[model samples]
Target: MSSVATASSGVSTPNDTRAGASTPWRRVIFGAGVGNALEWYDWSVYAVFAPFFAQQFFDATNAVSAMLSTLAVFAVGFVMRPLGGIFFGWFADRLGRQRAMVVSMAVTALGSLFIAVAPTYPSVGLVASALLLFARLAQGFGIGGEIGASYTYLAEAAPARRRGLWSSSMYVAVTIGVLLATVQAAALQGVLTDEQMTAWGWRIPFALGAVLGIYAFYLRRGLPETTAFSNARDTPEPEKQSMLRGIWENRIAVLRVVGLTVGGTVLFYTWAIGATNYAITVKGIDPDGALWAGVIANLVYIAALPVWGAVSDRWGRKTNLVIFSVGLGALSFPLNWLIQGSVWQLGLAMSVALVVHAAVASILPAMFAEMFPARVRASGMALPYSIAVAVAGGTAPYLRTYLAEAGMPSAFTWYTILLLAVGLVVIASMPETKGKKLE
Candidate 1:
């Protein structure tokens, strides 16, 4: 655990000591990465399986309303994310990232268990819907805090020179989790009849999520607290200074986090969740085809993440942002049009867009961590990032669906382009933090 803060990057280095040489890179990555994967798996499964379970929790007569109810619950869960951030970010800052992450996973697992065993509308009426809402709220809260704690840990654990690459690992793990969920959906659809999937098969993923979450909790417990937090902990604090006060002191960095997150979160939800959901629900594409298409597209995204991470390290964080905003902005309309109820078109469009998306996705965690000193780093990033995601990202899928149902699908595409344009403006004002030292 012995370390020194290097002069150049202000990051702790082991100075070629035994600890440095023996740093368990694999365990560190797996502990952090796997937990992230589990978090997303739990989060994404709700949307992936919503089509099947929508009627189970709501009125069965109006199918569209039932689906909307399910998505609304999904959005409600997302809305709770900021509250998760406020509490968990403070917990991470005041206590430690490791503790916050472990506790959040427990809450998430409990939520999954609730959904796994929730009574259906036939038996319990609106009570079923209430249980679903309660479960989502819990999951949302856990996920909210999970992001700050995990991102902070990964950023601090990484060597300064390779921070960008390390940051990308979180999203790579995220894509894997999403891929696994899609795979599960495809598998269930392949094996079960529609009636059977709706009746029972949809519950399998939630039940498995609870079990996997427990295992992730076990793995995370073994991870060491990062040197940055340990060092920050020992330093004297101003008497009675609160986490919110510290975040306020770093207000500019907090604003930057919001701006950096806004467009990327929206872009991520659109391609990752909205597009597939759209193809199935609106375009009438086969569920298996849509989910399988997502699998291939996600794989392409995974491969692109590391390459973009390298580019960010060599060029700068701002370079990646520019590429993401402009490239995705220009291609947004055509990609939207490409999803015409076919598996190949859906696969091609998602693959191309996600490749462009990797630029920003690869470096966001590092950029946010680097923006503030360690004292308020977790909270500073957490609040604004969660707020942005809740406001824009959480609403993305619903908005896309609503627009398409209104026979104005092109409007949603325009909305995406506008956000990307705004993101470009934010990128222009952003400092290049490629090799910057974390405080």
Candidate 2:
């Protein structure tokens, strides 16, 4: 065993190894994956249902204006992500990953519940809007913490050689959550009248998300703490340093997290969240067909995740990241231009873009976790990563919508290409850390 692994593992006897080995893989994956699914599910459903709920909480005079207002609230939620990361990351380091995860899930569920029960604009006037904003802020905070804690836990708990493969489960769970939202949107659209959907149907998913969050919280509470965190807790230096000092000590890695995420998060939101919106709102595709196509595309994304995870396991993390940045940089514009309003075109474009995205998405947990020692891994990664996603990813849908509305849709395409180019440079500069032992 590597020195780091041995230290993290403590002075393990044969019985200790046997005990660790006996823990079911199903439990590990579920504990981490379910909460992750809840986070993405809530986010995905918000985007999926935003068109339906826009007038419920915002101005009803102009459809486009209301949609933009709803999306702005979506962005507002993301604004809270950095704060969430800081608080939860610190809590994870000071407490345990398991406890932090449990609390995040609870908070996320509470946000969903608030949204589920929130009054419509007609009923409560602008107070409805304020409540919606608060709900999103709470959800953002929960998801922010959820990302850092979950990523850190998944990476540290995996077997050294299979960390990439194991880490891919994070996005597998995420994609599944997205798929669920798409499916629900399609189902709801098919069953409900347009008026019904706009009025009350939009709240169903949020209510369901709250229930699922409760279940995820239960699962996460059962998760065993990672050995790496246990070891870090025992280290005197790490124990003595405050969260800010610990993060400052690892400032270089923090910056790398920001640089690495800038392009990836933008691309992620572009396809994963915004593509359906683009098709329905921009290209005027039928909502039902576009959402179903989104379902298929999400399935393709899910299937591709573990494949790239396994590929990164063999080919190295840097190699997969280079492919992701370069491939996405080259293809983004062409793919964006390819969508000309047909459902099939939208599906193909989304599937192709997401397949490329899976390369980085599959390995992010492992890659980010590898960059820092366990002592500060969650907090070190949380602030920068959340900020990057907030700035780039959160704004993607709004920017794309605004640009397309202005008759310059290609401008957003170029913006994505530029970020991907930046990502390529950062990827080139980063050292390969595949199979590196965790501290």
Candidate 3:
């Protein structure tokens, strides 16, 4: 946006523009990250609170069955993500990022509010389950689009040299959001009796998420359009083409997006999201203890994020991802086996896994953003990434539950390993995007 351009290592660093671009990158990152945190805050709370609330939504033979059913509904939210991505990506690509993000946050807030006040199975029979599903669908759609817009904005707004370090804010915000969810649940557990939690206490987190979304909306509303997007928006088209056709022409990049996400999302949701519950269920840890495990582990992961992100800034994004894929693939089973013990074991396993996962999580925004030009960046990244999450990450918890009930939780470790291998292949084939100029 500015005449002052940097070609250090052939990278074109973003410069401030007077038209609509904002400077001092910290505000840009904070504006984008806050909304993302609220979206994930609602998402994580559901998974963590499922055990207490599952009975309210389903009639089942046992607690496990009820929890499994709730998780299946959880997976339902994921199924809607790709559709959300397509619609919202098209909107963001055509209109503006700020509009797309604000609306997504509002819709997500509405979904959480619905869950906060949903009736129980006894009060409304199967209708209660239907309400939960509807709420999740709205959330899934909102969050699906939230990712594409937020990542694109962060990548575009940051200085080129420090992009990796700045972009890691997304995961940092997510870890904080997840930590808050766990802590809230833990604190509530202390204050309320189990019967009270089952009856109504589970709703507090969702209610709180809805309020947080309001603040997120307020922060994001004032963000100026990024110089990258503005430049793309202002340039004359070389040839007239539909956004869908453009995306179709870049099918390989789209597929690469899916490949890039498969392992990261699977490994992330399986261990990061599912581990806490796994501790309570399979390992016989107390619920509060399991919640505390999640809280403490996320705190450590949050602290380590900047360190790994800076490493990717100097070393390479591909290097971190390769380490992530190889480490997770080689160690999933051993880690799974290790966590099959006490609260300390669960905390250790989650922290170790997240520390490894940080290699990918910290660099993913820059990696995917670098894959596509600014013209179609949001749409290109959103569609395929959403599809991958829907297929892999969305179902990880449910698949683990199903396999565990079938007496084969260890089998999931092998499944994760196979996908991580595919990710490694994708990573190896892709060029090193470190310091590569955004097209």
User: What local lDDT does model 3 show for residue 2?
Assistant: 24
- Clash number for candidate 2: 0
Candidate 3 lDDT by residue in tens digits, 62-95: 7788788898888788888888888778777777
Give the poorly placed runs of model 3, Cα more than 4 Å off: 1-23, 51-72, 118-130, 237-240, 404-409
Query: Which residue pairs clash within candidate 1?
Result: none
Q: What lDDT would candidate 2 get against the real structure?
A: 0.85
Clashes of each: 0, 0, 0
- For candidate 2, list the clashing residue pairs, or say none: none
Residue 139 of model 2: what lDDT? Answer: 95
User: Can you write out model 1's per-residue Cα lDDT over 371-420, one digit (the tens) per residue?
Assistant: 88888888889899999988988788889999999999989889888888
Q: lDDT: which candidate is best?
A: 2
In model 2, the worst 10-residue window by lDDT is: 13-22
| Candidate 2 to native Cα RMSD, angstroms | 3.7
